[model samples]
Target chain A: MFAFFLSSGLFLGWSLGANDASNVFGTAVGSRMVKFRTAAIVCSVFVILGAVISGSGASHTLGKLGSVNAIAGAFMVAFAAAMSVYLMTLARYPVSTSQAIVGAIIGWNLFTGSRIDTNSLTKIVLTWVACPILSAVFAMIIYKLVALYIKFMKIHMFKLDSMTRYGLFFAGALGSYSLGANNIANVMGVFVPVSPFSSISFYGLFTLTSAQQLFLIGSLAIAVGVFTYSKRVMLTVGTGIFQLSPVAAFVCVVAHSIVLLLFASQGLERFLISHNIPPIPLVPVSSSQAIVGAVIGIGLLKGGRGIQWKTVAGITSGWIVTPIIAALISFISLFFLQNVFQQKTYRPVGYLITIDAAQRIRDGGVSEEKFKGLQGREFPTAVKFSNALSEYTELTREERDLIVLSAQMDEMEITRSGITGLDTNWITPEQIAALELLEGRVFDHQWQLDEALAEVSPYWRFREDDDKYNRDLRQKLSYIYRFFRYG
Target chain B: MSKGILRKQIGIEKQIDEFLDLISESGLIFKAGIGAYLNGKTDDFLRKIEQITDAEHRGDSLRRTLEERLYIQTLIPESRGDVLELLENLDSLLDQFKGAIWQFEIERPEIGPEFHEDFKEVVKYAVESVESIILSSRAFFKNIAAVADHMHKVSYWETESDKVSSNLQRAIFRRKDLSMSHRLQLRDFARQVDNIADVAEDVADRLAIYVIKRSL
Candidate 1:
């Protein structure tokens, strides 16, 4: 049953591969510089490697924007995104899976009444607009440099041709890797919060966590998409549209891959933050947009005579229409999946106010005096609690949600000491060593200790793969840790 | 794989060169045919004409084959139009050679003692101009920088042919030893031979333009 629910995510991954793979190797294959078979093989292998290894970074941003809590909700969100991409592709318009998935997530947020992180959402939207423009700029610069090199070097015609052929294959491989790393978030991101698999140890060599397993499955679906349906699209992009020179094609692919890598690299983002620079938001951007921008850049550099304006207009309109259609489709599908199919599209969470809850609300910097009249009242959901609290005190949505989430504690007595006292039968020796190292170091949340141990030893993590639970654990642990250390 | 495609294009380019060779070879045969007719060797003149006709036929076949290869293979799509135009213009020079030689064979113009050497000189200059143009066209596919130098020689020979044709026509009209009709026929023959150099110059001019376009 869980596997059946994952089909939608797989479908989305397949559609992503089918459409975006053309952006990577279309020109090379279309120009007859590289064989389609070789391009497809390299793309499939590298894409899977990128998805399994570095697909987590952009997914965190997607998670922040909206957390689809139920498997049914996740299915609908991915399904809506895949359908939008498919329909737009059929219409011969370049569509962005990033835009489709983001819109569908926003629709899910609206349906579930979840608190949307506007800051993260705004950053994601800004990047979507910036991604193509940046690629265009990069391509223009690169194209100019290439032209200068050709003019100055007076390279032999055959040598220039061979060099471009090799450059295209290299750029195509890099593009595939970047695509897998960045866009895998859109494919399997919704499922990240409802992953059904547990960490499975393969003879103690390495543990395949639920998130990694889900990503692996999604990568396979993408590989299937590349092999089966991307050839005709590649041909269209390569020769059917604007006939690109081999060097111009190389410039476009390289520029596109660079933009995707910049957006997807968590290491780069971390480096920037650590250096006190404004970090680049890790987001899935449309590869189609990037490549189109690159081609336009090259065309403009050559005095802009050969560009097909009508096609550009059609593509831009498709970009505008795709997200709205996806959002509408997601909203309608969730309504049916929940009401008609009787599936839990959203798990309504309840909250109860207590002495600990009041303390947490105070800790969250909210005035406890406003909650004095209803200190012991219960609310069926965080939205309900926020609404009731809003009636008494003036509070913004984020602050209200933050207060409710912090105040509404689970009844389970989870603590660092309790984590230490749990059964050690399944714990690895590395986890034991890590725990011993933290004997004197106090942790506030039990799951924080679990995460810290998991960092040291992969075996100590939770069986469930939901990023929301893991994020909640980290957030609560940080708050409690701050309270203990400061006060 | 790219090398393979390039090799195919090179093959087609080589075929074009071969076609140019056939034209130059036909020009030599046409000159020989004119020389035999001037010497009143009717049998040899007829044989040389046959040879010129055969060369023209081969040149025609080769031009057709080159056109089909270019269109079917799409070897140099960006410059195919320019290349086809160059081929057509060059091929017309061969037609001029065949047409002028056949006219000489049919008319059998009276080559007076005074104009025989001059007539042969005109034919020599015309053939030399064509040979220079062929070399220039070959240089186009080999070393573009050398094309200008070869085209310069073609221009030089064409001017010499122009001077000789004018002098020969003036001498023919000024003559009192021949009939007006015969003199008129001789002048016409001189113009036909000089037209070969004129046609070669036209083809060379087109080649220069194509080279410029390709280099850019």
Candidate 2:
């Protein structure tokens, strides 16, 4: 049963990757600061570290669900949770895998007429309400602080670029770490109870160090999410909500992380309550929703004109339906399967699995199988591995006419010596595919001389006297030489 | 075929209209006149350039009393080579007007059977060029290019001022009583002044290019 919950945690980890990875570095990638690949690689390293170190608390919470009949029942619950979150992610709504998993186990517990912890459910629900509002308030304060610093320094040109780039890189790394630390348990905790032989503490001297090992799982899952369908979500977030400036993007991510960490720490929540400060609700709130709410705060400050209402409505509507659907599916699916399917389950012709691959080499030779009863997955349906390769360059015909844009990106990497981007790095395989796909295909040879001379400054920044008004000047000049004849 | 022909006709008519309007805006021409006179060639041209130097101070005050104000510039079209040509003419016009003050050029108009006749010759070219331009233009239109060819006659006369100076200097030297320093000073007076017509030729060339480029 404990092993069942662990598998469910792994599924949730995948969904978490899809939903929250975008929140970390989406702006930077969309703004062309960093490639999605580099961000994912960084995210993979740090998120795993974060999960190994900090994932245990959330994993333990998910594993504590008491309704499973055997280790397989635990796996069933985790599977239902994973499926629920992935479906929501595919629809482009970033539902919290944390919330979905929690809701799943709760609904699963109730359907079997097992003991449901109403107290825990209430605490989790309160977090759902408080997290977004707190994140927005924090972002507003951060924005005001950044604005004040700029006004005080009267900064411009070179100083602004150098300092902001370094600071943004550091922030991206930190955000990735915090996300991994906070989000990893959404995939790993349930396995703790079922695996007596594999039972290792998630924290401390364990190989993954508590929730941090979950980081690898979460990172891969989220990478798939980012690489596969993040373009629409990124567009909706970056260009739609207040047309994010770099400072605004930074503030949104920072505030979102602060809120995620608040919920992640029981010690912190307890400390806050012991004082006059309000307690953080125990439920796992989404890093995506927290970030979006903060973005909206920024947009509102910028004014209604910049906020695209249609997109916001679409995003908000998804958050509303995702968990309810997950819960219904888990309840109906888990309940019917446990009662009806258990009796008629086919017994496998047990086969021996390679033991060395499953164990470390020792003086005593290949160690005995760490745990047996390795059952094969069987259901009314087969699990299809849905890994997709992204074609970012070929996605647009006119924008793909950005043949020049891709060339410029490669040149920027060459001259700048590495990828420049903003936000947290999480390794999601999908992001890797997106990055690899962009290689060698970007228009490299057509305008090398042009990039060197006239376009010395980054296209992202506007500093020229007329650039503020001359939005079409680039297009005009490109074709002007063709038409401007003296003969 | 019909549409193509109409489009070509429309283009040409528009070009001509633009040419006419450019040459004949009298208000602008008047500003050009003062700019020309004040900025005329010499070390003292500083006095004229400063007159319109402050962009804010230019208005009817500078325009109405131009003859009194040596500060008044006749160099309109402030950013172009046309100013250089106009200023060359103004220098000769100033000398002609000054010689009229002495009444010597009218009495004897020959070289220095008049010392001032060279100046008179250059100013004649200037006056003729301006008059020809006015006759070929109405309101803000120009047919001045065809008549503009005749101004070269005055230009040739302006060029003749050089021979007048050389002859006069030879005569000064022939006279036994004249001091060497006084004769040297006489030689210097008419040297730079004779190049006014060349300046006018330059202005005409530049203006023609400007017109052509504008499809005028």
Candidate 3:
């Protein structure tokens, strides 16, 4: 049972790395303000710091809501949470692992006949629901006020800008720690159901509580998530929000923190829910979505016309569909893997052959009659033609065209050689006869080469229709290819 | 002077003053552009003004002045295309100045209905630079560098303005309100304003460059 829970945690960690890491540095990475490597480092370090410092909050909620901590119970909770999260990720959705963990715990507790803490669950759910909306509002409200102040005090906008750059850098660093502290639940939620810190430790601390170990392990997992899979998510999140003003960013932080704290509370539902309070489920929500929502809300405040509907729809859809799709995919993949293991049969994958192999026929690469006839004509032999293909690849597009052009010249050389009224002073009779004989064979060899290329790639068909000089190129090639019906 | 010459001289003086007024006014507009930039306003007036530096508008303006004035001479006259070039450079400088202003607006655009003191020092110098040109026309080399001195003052203000712009950008991005785009445009706006001031200094430099070359 302990092994099951541990393995589940590792699986959850992989999924969390894939989906949740983006939450930490998605905006920075998306905008290319920080490279992937830099973002990863900052996220990992700060997450570790946050987890080490303040990671105990979620640990209490996950572990202590009932009488005794059982390893079997913890294992069950971890498996359910991991399964839920893993299912969500493969579908390219950004579901909250924290929410999934919380839900799974409740499900397990309910099944085990344990009393559910509706009030705490309500607070958690409300936070999930409110997180994105509140983040957006915070960004909007603070953005408007602070931006207004900065604009009015134009005396030192430039100076203030330098200050902002430094400040944001500071915030980014701070945010990392917050992520470690706040998001550890996504990592260590299951550990709560088992023995309270019996097997976990920190540094050389004696009898470290379960909460403390969660702080360390959760931070470590988050760091891994940040380093591994944060970029893709960050890009999705960053572009989801309209280009933000400094004020908007400030507001978003305030909103996210407040909302997160609201959910983090033990008695949030009874404390905040009014008679007409909006119904919100207990779940962990996304901060990125909250900020994005806030940005859109501001735009909507201006009017629907001001809001970019497409961007809004795209983001909302991503929010809605990500989890379900991930769930579906995970279900299917797991099913397939299970069935495949049971079947014990794997199909072998097929082989490829080359032109060189075709040329190696004992019957001869070409017929003697055709080969001799081609020799009498202008075409070069197979060996020479093969060399041209290798040489052509080395040339640029323009040089390749020049090679095609030389094919026409080879024909001209034959025609010029056979010119009955030509002056013999510039050309000799023997050379003329040789040129005449070589022309047909050379031209035919070039044709055969063209046919071969057409079989493999069909270069002309691959050309983009929008190419400006394509018409001209086609016209020039009209005569040469006319015999082969290229026109 | 005939009434026509008197009217023309008055016209030149008025136009020169108006141009200077526009420079100052545009500087404010430039500030607004900065505000807009910082505030994350994509549609900035300053950014539009910066686009004026393009060949079409300036080129057309240059053409008009050439056609109106005695600019295309067979032999280089004592008074060559100096006025024509001067006006062209002035227009270019203003365009660049306007561009700089947009940088501020773009990077941190959230101007309220209040005045921006950051522009006061920079604007004074710019105004002085314009006044120097007008004064130079009236007194031509008589009070050398007196107007140039004011232009020198413009340069100092520009440097100060640079500090202000940099400060604003840093401050704006630091605030939680700014997005990635907001910070970028804010920085751009600040740098652009400094560039405008630099162009104003370039005007002064051109004046000096022209004199040194011609006088020698």
> Which predicted model would earn the best TM-score?
1
Model 2, B1-216: lDDT tens digits are: 334433443443343333333322321332343234323433233333333232213322222233222122211111123323333333333333233222322232123334444444434444444333333221112232343454444445444544664565676567556677655654543443343334444444444554342121
- CA lDDT, every prediction? 0.74, 0.47, 0.48
Residue A25 lDDT, candidate 2, scale 0-100: 71
Relative to the real complex, the DockQ score for model 2 comes to 0.01
Give the lowest summed-lDDT range of ten residues in model 1 chain A. A478-487
lDDT of 1 by residue, B1-101 (tens): 65676576566656776898888888888888888888888899899888878888888888899888767754444456777887788888888988998
Give fnat, all candidates: 0.00, 0.00, 0.00
- The candidates' DockQ values read 0.15, 0.01, 0.01
- lDDT, candidate 2, A452-480, per-residue tens: 32344333223464332233334322322
Residue lDDT tens for model 3, B75-162:
1222235545666666675566545553444444543222245434434444444445444432322233243445456556556666
Q: Interface RMSD in Å per candidate, to 1 decimal?
A: 5.1, 26.4, 24.0
Please report how far candidate 2 places residue B101 from its true position, in Å.
Answer: 38
Off by over 4 Å in 2: A1-9, A56-69, A120-128, A196-232, A261-264, A269-285, A343-487, B1-216
Q: Highest lDDT: give the candidate number.
A: 1
